[model samples]
Target: MRVYPEQLARQLNPLTPCYLIFGDDPWLVETSKAQICAAAKQQGFEEKVQLTQETGFNWHELQQEWQAMSLFASRRIIELTLPQAKPGTEGSQTLQSLLQQPNPDMLLIIQGPKLASEQTNSKWFKSLDSQGVYVPCITPEGPQFQRWLDARIKHFGLRLQADARAMLFALYEGNLLAADQAMQLLQLLSPEQPIGADELGHYFEDQSRFSVFQLTDALLGNKQDKAQHMLAQLHGEGTAMPILLWSLFKELTLLLQLKSAQAQGTGLNSLWSKHRIWDKRKPLYQAALERLTLPQIEHMLATASKLELMLKQQGVEDWTALSHLCLLFDPKAHKHLAHIELY
Candidate 1:
């Protein structure tokens, strides 16, 4: 019942009784936890009870939570985070007992730091792994790191030209989170052409100034004032209009994809994993998916396409229309756009 981090999603179907996610990498550990939680929610594990193995920890709470019924949901998840990576005598006894008496209504998830050789061979750890899943979140290094980076770049549908690939590899060798973000920005900025290392540096410098990402973040969070401010700043700073438009179009395309997936009755967790959504940012996107209508996104996306064509013309600088396009993402601004057209 051992699973690799990348293979975790395929194995998530038919929920497991227990999942043990242990790792040293923060991003990997957090992302694995999010994926599991997303999968658990789809399987009706709506309510969650969190426990930490810290000072004066109550080992008996696990048993109590297992036997307890939820007022909010019929089924619930019990997440035990072990900072020490080891359960002491009482904790061991409690875990063995809980495993002996498994309850279908409760899903047990345990996470902690990376395990040593002796720790993995322990009786309790073996029992848990045999019964459920053991996901070890070790950060990738060297070639393994390269493979991970390549997968992320491919996921974003990007082509790296000249020394761009080598430069990127050297830039984010050990940091998976930064690599993903870099690729995301690149994907948004240039979806159709091969990008060079020089362009990479230039785009990231502008990103530091108030990234296209920040604007998208503002739009996703429905922060009208912040999005408008960032958009105007980007314009004043000479951000290419096509790049801004492409980023918005990319976000709208994702929204449409998520909406279509929902209509087809897909699980949120699977969609998130397939789309490579990280854990911390799920709430922003989840809110957008729940709130925005398909028709609204389609209409705005159409306008963006037209705007793209218009921006290609010589001597045409329409910052106002782009400002209006940013507002189209706001559900509150729908009324403002209802009586007008932008082309």
Candidate 2:
């Protein structure tokens, strides 16, 4: 009943009736949730009903939705997002009842923040364990992060020099989302180019010509005007929009994580060590963390994701989408623009 995040992809074919994915790492949690949803869709679970544990949320609605038939969709996926992982007495009874009579027409997905040891051993959890799959999404740290980075780079069909690997590890050690984004940017900026410390440093830290890395740092520092200029420079250089969007969204994701950690009382020094942030870059992260709240950072990320989808799926103009995303970080742009639309 217990499965690792990586293993869930292969396990999706003979889809289980229920899935319980819990973890603290937002990146990992989101990745696993997306993969499961994708697999469900591939298996013809087209209709999705999402339920979140918010104040005034009626738990009975879940049962009603489960029992209802969709006129269009043959099968459906019911997603319950328990942000706090505390399914109350009513929720627990509902879960127990659902498991007692598993639905064949709907796939139930329970997602939440990490669970405590005691909570995991509860009767409700045991019911999930016996009947479905439980996946724990933990962020890798230390050497584990190193391996994750290496694998991620290779997965992107790219190779990195040894020193470049170390440099990337130092820059994006604890943050998988950023590391992955960095790789994607690299692929776009220099397709088929070897990844080395110099290659990474050229864009990330050095005085290279206007580059994606520089734009990322500018966004992190919340230098709106500077970001706009660099974005213009990159666009002028014929840089691809997907790569630019990837870099911006990646930085926003890291900022959101750091902001969340700081809000949760994690010290700057501890974060630095945990994330292997270097001396020069610490101030940028610190400033961004202080300037942006978790909600604002999340909103930026959501907006960037929307732009990416628009460019890829809806065939929107690449420069238009990238320009709109750049505006999200620019104060001046905000004053001029009426409002940003998100999909």
Best by lDDT: 1
List candidate 1 stretches off by more than 4 Å: 204-343
- Tens-place lDDT digits, model 2, residues 1-343: 8898877887788788899999877778888889989988887898989899899878899889888888895899999999888888898888888867767879999999888987798888888888889999877754677777877888887777899888887666445666777888888887787878877888664211356877888777777766676777677668888788778877887777788888888888887877778897999898877766676667678777777788789978557656676665644455455265655
Clashing pairs in 2: none
- What's the CA error at residue 28 for candidate 2, in Å? 0.9
> Candidate 2 — what's its lDDT?
0.78
Q: List runs of model 2 lying over 4 Å from the truth.
A: 205-343
Model 2 scores a TM of: 0.59
TM-score (C-alpha, index-matched) for candidate 1: 0.58
Best by TM-score: 2
Give all candidates' CA lDDT scores: 0.82, 0.78
Q: After superposition, how far is residue 81 of candidate 2 from its true place, in Å?
A: 0.8
Per-model TM-score on C-alpha atoms: 0.58, 0.59
How would you encode candidate 1's per-residue C-alpha lDDT over 52-155 as one tens digit per residue?
99998988887898788899867999999999888988888788778788788898999999999887988788888888999999877647877887777888
